[model samples]
Target: MTTLTLNAALHLDDFSLEVDEQIPLQAITALFGASGAGKTTLLRIVSGLHREAKARIALNGEVWQDSDNGIFVPPHLRSAGYIFQDIRLFSHLTVAGNLEFGRRRAAAGDGPALEDVIRIFDLKSLLQRAPDSLSGGELQRVSIARALLRNPTLLLMDEPLSALDARRKSEILPYIEKLPERFGLPVLYVTHNVDEVARLASRIVLLSQGRVIAHGDATEVLARTDLKPLADHLDPGAVLEATVIEHRGGMATLGVGTQRLRVPGISVESGIDVRIRIQARDVALAIQQPQGLSIRNVLDARILKIEHYGEILAEVLLDVGGQQLRSSITREAAEELHLQQDIAVYALIKSVAIDVGLAG
Candidate 1:
């Protein structure tokens, strides 16, 4: 497997970034953290736009920067396609003209041809339009298409959706989700939104205060209670890999490991793979499986661990058919139910509480 290695130390007036990590080059690797966590700064270092003393950056054995050896490749020299928060298309030119500019700067490597780039990004209809006439989602799509036209070895995106509203963000996510498979390039995406990370990232390099606090599979990293304080502002949830079993009565049955979950509003056809996010706050635990309830989803689970956060809340980790599930409950409920590690329980979930998306 290919990997990107970064070892660097940078100090600013009030913030400093120190990271030493080897991230796998597959799908999307999210550099996730709150603002000022040096996510963009780290991305810049990798893009050869920012340099640190004695910093070392390499991708799949190709060294981009090694400060000690006086080896540093310029941003333009390195095959990195960068898409910033602002869609930096040339306002003076039509969308086709802007894309042609990217095609002109193409590297000698095996990059996508102009026609293939247009097809991949679904930009054929918008090619003749002006940048200002496009919507936020459309602009980003064109931006991504222009970036891919350069045929970079990897892609760097710094909060590409941060500026868009919820609707536009949703409008463009499906396209971004298909980048790695569609373009055959590794993407280092930086975002603070856990939802984006959960939806798009296969590997997560979680940063905090300019340091890497955790790095691994997206499901494992996001379910960790230890990272709660950093992500407390975001929703706490467990990401499960499930397969569509069948559709019946407007709901879809998804198989999570050996268990089954029935969710509503799943439009995908049966037999497709999907990722579902179950928020801890939406899960309720029962000592026994309850009957005659309106809830349609319940799974056999065993308590893996319990952690108390703040004063009134507790986060319980559970083993449900070999996959992890989390529940956030009041401390009073934990004491009342006598919940403890290794105890058998039932996990109740509402069909509407589940967030479903296509898995990469």
Candidate 2:
């Protein structure tokens, strides 16, 4: 596995970022935290955009920054591609020109073919169109395509979708989703939005005050009781890959490992793989196997643990085929049901609760 080790200290006004973390080079490692939590600063440090009083940045085993050796690699030559929050496409350039600018700057033998990037980003119609003439989604697509043309070992994106409207964000999400599969390059994605983290990150680094508070799989990291404020609405009880069994009109039939689910309002081809999120709030407990309930999803789950965080809310940890899934309910509900570890129960969910993993 490619690994990144950073030991740095930076002073920003009254607060400081004294970070020391070893981040694995996975498909996408998200730097997630609340605002002023040093998410952006850490990205800057990695990109060599922000310097530190004492810095050591290395990938795999190569030294990028070391204080004692005075080894500091500048940002321009890091073999890294960066997508700024602004989608900084040059006004003078057309969509095609903006996409090819990176190739023009690369070593003669290493640059991607001009046509390859066009196909990757679906830039056919926009090739001759100017940047001002493109929609927000089109512009971001061009920006990401331009960065990929650099042949970067790693890609850095700083909330690239934050500037767009909901519709635009949806338009650009699939492109971002394809990055890990298409390029085989690790992406250091920075975002304060938790839903984005859930949909995109293969691995996650939870930062608080420039320190790595939590680092693990995306679902586990987001469910931490400590970070609940940021993950309130992103409470996907479980995430599982499913096969699209059939597609008729605007709906889809999905098979999640052992269970079958019917989802609404989606455009998916048959036999394709899709990711599903079972929201914690959407799951209801049953003493026996449910037969005639209006709910469609009923998994035979075992209670693993229980955690109460507030006067009204309590979270139950359930095990579904050795994979942990979360369920949220009132404290009174837990008591009324006499919930405890090792108790066998059924998890009920409706078809409407299922959502496509494309939200910003």
Candidate 3:
């Protein structure tokens, strides 16, 4: 498998970042962290834009930077397509003009046809419009199309959706999700939004205070509560990939591993795959499967571990049909139930607490 290898050290007056990692170039990999956590800086290093850092960066065996050998490849030569938070489309050019500029810069070989890009991004109607006349979501879609025109080997996105409001984000995410599989491209996406991470990223590199706290499969990394950076996030949760079994009576039954989950207000065709995000706080643990309850979803689970956060609360890790799930409860409740590792319990989740998105 192809991989991006990075061994970097960046030191500032108050903050220092040291990362040594080998990221697989299989699909979208998220660089997740809070502000001032060095996510953007690391992305710049990988793109060969931040040359001051002492680093050795390589992509799929090609060395982009080697500080010790005094070798450096400039950003343009790296062939990495970068997307910033702000839409940087030229106001003087029409959408088609902007796209043509990028297409003309393609290195060699046949690049993606303009018609194909326009169709993929649904941009046919907007081609004649100038950049200033487009909506935020439309502008972002155009920006992405322009990048694809370059026929880049890798894509780098620095919180591209941060500037968009909820509705605009929703409008543009589906388009972004299609890029990797549609073009066979590997993307290094940076974002702090866990929901975006759940839907878009297959792997995660969790950073905190300028260091990697955890890195692995998205499901495994998000299920962890031991990391303070992740735990502090508002919606710490477990991400599950499930296939739609059926939708009936205002509920959708999803097949996750061998277990089934019923979510409310979701209408999707049977056999479709979806990504589900269940917040840790929304999961309630019961000693046994309750007979009478308003909750519509329950799964047999085994306690993997329990982490106490001071004296107020505790986070419980669970194994549900071989997939990780997390529950956050009060410390007093945990002590009352005598919760511990290697114990069986029922995980109760309210149907309304789940967030569903298309599986990328």
- Specify the highest-lDDT model's number: 3
Q: Which model, 1 or 2, shows the larger TM-score?
A: 1
Query: Against the correct fold, how does model 1 do in TM-score?
Result: 0.68
**TM-score per candidate, in order?**
0.68, 0.66, 0.69
lDDT of candidate 2 over 274-346, digit per residue (tens):
6566667767887688787777667778999997745798888888766567788899999999999999998
- After superposing candidate 2 on the true structure, give the runs of residues whose Cα lies further than 4 Å from its correct spot: 107-112, 228-360
Error of 1 at 165 (Å): 1.0
Highest TM-score model number: 3
Candidate 3 lDDT score relative to the true structure: 0.85
> Rank by lDDT, descending?
3, 1, 2
User: What lDDT score goes with residue 147 in model 1?
Assistant: 92
Candidate 3, residue 95: how far the Cα is off, in Å: 1.0
How would you encode candidate 1's per-residue C-alpha lDDT over 1-360 as one tens digit per residue? Answer: 668989988988898888999888799999999888889999999998886545799989899998888999999998899998998999999999999988899989777888888887788999899998999888998999999988898999999999899889977888889889888888999999877886799999999898999999987787664564344435523767788899999878889898888887577778888767677877999998799998888999999999875369898999888888889899999999999999999999863333333344
**lDDT (10s digit) by residue, model 3, range 22-126:** 998768999999999999999999998899999999988899999999989998888788898897998899999999988989857677898999999999999
Backbone clashes in model 3, listed as residue pairs = none
**lDDT of model 1, residue 268:** 75
Q: List ranges where model 1 is wrong by over 4 Å.
A: 52-54, 236-360
Q: Which ten residues in a row have the lowest lDDT in candidate 2?
A: 351-360
